[model samples]
Target: MENIKFIDQNLEKGLYLVSTPIGNLADITIRALNILKKSDIILCEDKRVSKKLLDYYDIKVQLFSYHKFNEKESVEKILEIFKKNKIVSLISDAGTPLISDPGKILINEIEKNNIKIISIPGPSAVTAAFSLAGYSDDYYFYGFLPKKLGERKKVYEQFSNLESSIIIFLPARDLVSIIKEMKEFLGDRQITIAKEITKIHENIIKGNLDNILDKIKTVVLKGEVTIVLSSEANKNKDQNIDINKEILDLSKKMKTADLAKYLAKKFKFSKKEIYQKILIFNKK
Candidate 1:
């Protein structure tokens, strides 16, 4: 065992974005423990969830709830603490703060006020999933697919044709439906599903979209999930396709928004870009 030094006085007056473990409590760094132990107040998404981690490590710091609903109300009150040169730390219920989590608004205010902000980085699901997936040299990450059907379609469409692997964080419950939908848009592309990463029952499942869908039906999946999608191998290569002609043909049958969204997902271009092109073609 190694002796770890816990720094308290060096914890300067500012906002500390501490990264907590996604599943395993031992994944947390010694520095993060020090900051959490010494900070005047720890702003967390949920006090109940955060308490489990705090109690696990014997950290008795003051905890406060600052989730999305109360975030607008808490900004100024937190800034006032910063003005008094008090050390404040912000953490999500799991993983790092502001990664598909609240704290962006608070961070903006902190920077605007010119108060210092420190990052005590540690475990994150994105990197964890990517490392385990081993699909590509590079990848695109979409944290939590959109809830609305149209928006979700657009998200799947946007990444459908990407050469790089797509990493996403989604609920385990929606796994079956999401895969069925992805199969429609993305075909039987290979994917790796990392469930409850770093925890005791952590399971990583890998197969094409079709097979994994069947496999998941055998068991009930609980807790959070991270998915990594391998790039399409042979079909829908963008370079050989005619964007203008596809747009022209689809425009005849589809609404402008729908066509833009459809083609946006089919090609590498964005919806806004495709929409503008369709508008220009309409002018002719």
Candidate 2:
């Protein structure tokens, strides 16, 4: 499907997993807009919240509240409509459905009933943050942080070891605490915190846990935050290198200690290891 092109054709009369903008109003794709506009009935997290977007675009389709708390009932209500052969569209307050949201139940129900699910993808904060992070793209998506510290630590450790970039959705109130905990669990890990995505005051703060704390010290951090962290091993920095080449260059006129220091600075390693390598190379 082309970007910014509206879907003008007839869609199957079941469920449409429509993606909305994570941040930046313009991020919404034409396909998503087309689906939202053409849907017979729209299921949203909040009627008022979704209405703002719908009304802004002059969408007058039927809107209803369908969220985790009311999902069981909503499912039955939705099924009633589906039986009538009406096409239903599901959207979250922001971003794609089922990412820290409860739009998946309807999708599962539709699948179980042997109905089809049409997907019209749109912008995601996870994607937005990663693109601007200036970090490696290989990553995983964790919808949200665990409520308990132990559980969160377990999750954090796993990501830290893999050294893969991670995207986490966090409540505004818990943002500072979560960042602080991340600092303790993982040392010197880089993070990019994006807040109020797409809307004004959209901020992407990039730094280590401690550095970010300092940055947000005087500022009032409102709105939800999507935390994007660099992998445990940052590839942009000189962590991985050819030790053979390192030794070859060190053997030429530089003392082991000096060479080790130089290599250590370039590649995030201790000087002692490089120094020993130099001695071993010098002996040969």
lDDT of each: 0.84, 0.76
Q: Cα deviation of 235 in candidate 1 (Å)?
A: 7.7
lDDT of 1 by residue, 90-167 (tens): 999889899999998999988999998999999899999999988878989889998998999888778865789999
- Per-residue lDDT, model 1, residue 134, is 80
Model 2 poorest 10 in a row by lDDT: 235-244
Error of 2 at 97 (Å): 1.0
- Write down the TM-score for model 1: 0.80
Task: Give TM-scores for every candidate, taking all chains together and pairing residue i with residue i.
Answer: 0.80, 0.79
Per-residue error for 142 in candidate 1, Å, reads 0.9
Q: Count the clashes in each prediction.
A: 1, 4
Give Cα distance to truth, residue 35, candidate 1, Å.
Answer: 1.0
Q: Name the 10 consecutive residues with the lowest summed lDDT in model 1.
A: 232-241
Most TM-score-accurate candidate: 1
The alpha-carbon lDDT assigned to residue 66 of candidate 2 equals 90
RMSD of each: 6.1, 7.1
After superposing candidate 2 on the true structure, give the runs of residues whose Cα lies further than 4 Å from its correct spot: 1-8, 235-284
